[model samples]
Target: MKKIIILLLAVVAFSFKTKAQTFHVPENYTLKEKADYGKYEDDVIKGIDWLQDTPWPLEEQKRMETNVFLMKWIQGSPTVSIEINGSVAKMTEKNPQLLMTFMGGYTKYALQNKTAFDKNKANQAGVKAVIDKYVVETDHKNNSLLNKLTKIDKDGKLADWMTSDFNKTK
Candidate 1:
């Protein structure tokens, strides 16, 4: 009976350890390297997985850095943008607030870096679709992120993009 109790305790401890795991970017990693394209995609997926499994970072700087890293990755590749859209859709049920936080970050990043983001129309459309689905499927009226986004996009360009036929054909 003592041995069985010990075994159960060990299993519980192991589960806690696994659940506490968080993803961290590798040291010296560069997002600009042409040869590290595969690694970039893997890191972005891992980051999303981390967001789903772990609580968000407590530090403001850490959160902003994470957002910037993800935005850069999304901007750099259409493949990665598609992957993010699918993953975010899946995340809606499990962690919708996190998805909202991510969308808010992406929106802010795009507005601040218009030149870089404007060149990636496909990625922008994909992100817009994800946001549109999120808004429709979730109670977004009270969501602070969505509220802030509406204010930031004063010219309605982002709204226009979200309602475009691009998502309809998807």
Candidate 2:
């Protein structure tokens, strides 16, 4: 009986291991044509604007991860079970902090992972074009944020500056 139980456990474990899910980046998302290029550029600008409004002591890395999942979810099948890359990825997706996590992360995602998330990369979908420009703009804003962050010495000071900057701009 013990041997049989062990065999059953092994089978279950094997099945779980074999079923471990993997990320399916849609086939070769690349930019093509005048319209696509224009939209992509616009999206990039939008992404940069979003980042400028993000709170200081910027969590750019965290934001990037969230963007990757959002892009994947949107590009992949919406009805399909969104295979979030990790527990954090799942949390970021469902996270209520849209301003910080979702928006900021999306901007990061758009800027950094443009090639992977391009509308033309896979099935030649039209939707992806909307945000392509946003992501591209993010690249510039991302660099700006990094440059500003590097210049600052203290976290508290950075946070204060970011808040002040947002208020001033707003």
Q: Which regions in candidate 2 have their CA more than 4 angstroms from the true location?
A: 1-34, 51-83, 99-170
lDDT of 1 by residue, 42-153 (tens): 5665554444333443444555566667667666643333334443344344544545445533543444455566524544543443355444444333544344434434
What C-alpha lDDT values do all the predictions have?
0.50, 0.36
Q: Which candidate is the best by lDDT?
A: 1
Instruction: Return the top candidate by TM-score.
Output: 1
lDDT score, candidate 2, position 154: 28
Candidate 2, residue 15: lDDT: 63
TM-score of each: 0.39, 0.23
The residue-by-residue lDDT of candidate 2 on 1-170, one tens digit each, is 99999999999877644432222222344444434433344443343334334332355553464345444433442221222222223222332232233333344344455557642222111112222322334333333333343344224354444334422421
Give the TM-score (vs. native) of candidate 2. Answer: 0.23
Among residues 3 or more apart in sequence or in different chains, the pairs in candidate 1 whose N, CA or C atoms overlap within 3 Å are none
